[model samples]
Target: MLVLSLSTVAFLGLAQLADASGSPSTGHRRRTAGGGQAMNLVRSAPNSNEWSTQQWGHWAKTQKSSLEAKYGGAGASGTGVQKRATGTNYMTNQNGDSSYFGSLAIGTPPVSYNVILDTGSADLWLAGSDCTTGCSGVATFDPSSSSTFRNESSPFSITYGSGQAAGFLSQDVVQMAGFEVQNQIFAVCEQVSGGLLTAPVSGLLGLAFQTIASSRAPPFWETLVTEGAWDEPVMAFQLTRYLNVSGVQTLEPGGSFSMGFANSSLYTGDIDYVNLPVTGSYWVLPITSISVQNQSISPPSGQQAYAAIDTGTTLVGGPSSYIAQIFQQIPGSAPGTGDFESYYTYPCDTDVTVALSFGGRTWSISPADFRLARLTQRECLGAFFEIDSGGSSAPSWIVGDTFLKNVYSVFRYSPASVGFANLSAVALAQNGDASGAVPSATIGSSAARVSATGSMLPKAHRSAGIKIGCGLLYATSASLLITIAVAGVHSVLL
Candidate 1:
């Protein structure tokens, strides 16, 4: 599921689709802002989001840094009363699916700030007034100025694959999206290195569980759900698409990030719910099997191997062996050389399709998503990459925005689970124009491109809940419930 920060989850192992499986556990940093120009070629896309296939990768890299800190904790008591409010909260994505930012206010008067809505990690961190390295373009928070600020004095830090941030823990009246949490313990950076984050974003807001919070405190969103700030304990994301639209590199409306309830208008049909351990660390669920063009691939040990759904990630990665097996089934596919050593490339015109199943139900990904970037007139790089989720006990795959763009995603609490529903027709309206994506003029012609958006999908295997249930509202008898939607497109469309 999720670090998918959008979030990552460990897989225990898996049996056949017939067996209801469970079990297993396990495991970015900010980058300075500044990106290359996007290609402007207009081409057909499968889903609502349009990615930079020209980048030669999946929208899966941002969340990789935060995975190192495997901390766990429980929710602390809320500091103030609940503020039942709703308004338009916006997130910008100029670098394709690279990162997403939303409005978050802290302190008594609430100094508004922008943060990444990462479902991959669990701690809420932002640039502090005293921050050093890599603090160029982001707004900084001054703990001294906030009336509700409390100095915990405990040194706080999170290490990434290449960088780290050092600061102290502080509690403050924190507000985000539509809800606010009081005395929320968050990180205030004094020194940050390894090129953690760029401007246009102050920091990241983890939407995962409290179990993996680096601050060892309940994440801001979980606090809202745990205290019944809203009706249902759920947070959903409908990340739209766009890439370097109109030469603008930042502040473009990306999609919707909802809390408490799921937005019905954003999706269609029943929200196929994938159950997760309520006390689990990440928003992860089990995948019975994965297939390419109807060809099947399973976890090596036959155990429950999970796919962490991370929004911060740019590309999707899996065990090398399984990845190799997958490409072997695709004709003209081969190992890419240098720079792309672990990647695979296939015929530029190949309309490849990949399908995955949870609880016996299957959903297929669009072909435009499969082919990451074009290498020549006839060859292209694949979006799927090879990543070892550390050890065998960890997730075998990390599912990022690449796969999420094909469906509407929901992460629920209480009877913990994740929901993946098909997109509404309205949402898929611009599939050909790449919807949210604005291609740069450099992408050449669509004549050399490939897209399997119109390819036939594998028959969906039916499970009881597979085709049953009322669209993201699966028996909301949890004593509480609420619904929210930002704007549409230029605003929050969910």
Candidate 2:
């Protein structure tokens, strides 16, 4: 994520004004041209634009070094931990208009805006008063009266997997979890094109590293860091699937946003860190090999594709060629007869495993993770199609919840490393110590059973043709269990 210096002159002017009369100004030096001071009178003028530009250049270098030291070195070797806790929470309704779903009573009653937690792209934007009928059931964020609102009128636009939106920039007093983010720069999309307006979500809360943010705007994460609200420079997440019926839509204020160092007891061993390519502004993880059902398939050479470890995306997407090769490996897999390009279908009950190799580690995914949920019966549908051939040339993959549920994922932006720890290993290590260990139970109508002894050894669990290795043992019921294992450390069940 190379951050190009935007306008050297503009930055220099700002820095000069900020440092005026503060110190002796000892380090400030004049630039010489042709082995002589170019226009000695102008060059010596401290407030001249050229003089300020030189000062800015010196300060910019210092700022970069300071930022690196505070955040971490550039690329995957840097280390930082998320200041907040990470855990799974449920949405209340599917109708996309609810902005404030849950409320938190702090100095004033704070509302938990129904924000789409996205990791694919970095930007924290919400709907403003300019939003009209697009929001059906959600509350709109009105910035007109906020004392902190700063209307820049800067034009902004964002395109997503489904659609795009264009709007103007404005500053507002944004509050979350009792924390006030003052004069935060946000986008107010007056008009949105794409069906996203109809989804159950109201706005998007980007949680990705600040490196991959809109070129025109500073990211919400950066604002938080600049405000000194958090001590750590990293953030972590743990997403759970198939919560109890009563737990669905459980959006109460101050619920939980778990983040901390990886729990050692939750995994069988230490977490593995892998290096990735940091080119341009994206972090690209090279795929050493991709296999299905244990058979390896070769992808096009010199065609390195970067994948964003996105928790918001529900399905995995990648280059069409790569996806085709993967689906071809499945015994009964075939292309769908429709406009969809890379979509393929296989026998409903066929057992398959998709394995992806990255950074010397091979992470295998279960068929259930690849299967799409059908509108009826709630059964596994099929593998998600990756459409990368059209206007989109970037061979990127968005690894969603299906693949994430099996591992505990640690997203350390400070070091730019993604760590995976298998959940099965964690569950078995803590089976029954009166510390919320998972119990042996059966999930689904199938006769599959999950047995854990609460130890660091591996345990097996089977349900509906899906076989999982449980490592961490915490709590269990008829269909689900709170177990921990490596891959990061996650609770797993049906």
lDDT of 2 by residue, 1-494 (tens): 11110000000000010011011011331112111100000000012112222232332232222111111211111112223221122112111101111111101122233443344434455545576534433345566545445666455554322223556656554433223343445556665532333222335544444444442234444454433333343333333332111222211111112122343333444566666566333334666678888898884444445554544333455566788888887776776533333456677567678887666678887665565432122222354455332223233454544465456566555566667766545333321112221111111110111111111111222111111110111111111211111000000100
lDDT of each: 0.49, 0.35
Predict model 1's lDDT versus the native.
Answer: 0.49
Q: Every model's Cα RMSD, please?
A: 16.8, 23.3
Tens digit of per-residue lDDT, candidate 1, span 1-494: 13112122110000000000000001011111111111111111112123333323321232222221121111154333333322223344434344444556666656755555566566677778988775654578898888878887676655433345667777776654335555677778777653344443456666666655545567776666655565566767665554223332233335555665666766888988888633466666666778999988764444335666666554577678888988998999998764566778899778899988766479888776676556677877787777644443445566666687788888888788888999887546633223343211110111111110111112232111110000000000111111100000000000
User: How far is 201's C-alpha from truth in model 2 (Å)?
Assistant: 2.3
Worst 10 residues of 2 by lDDT: 37-46
Best by lDDT: 1
What's the number of clashes in each of the models? Answer: 64, 48
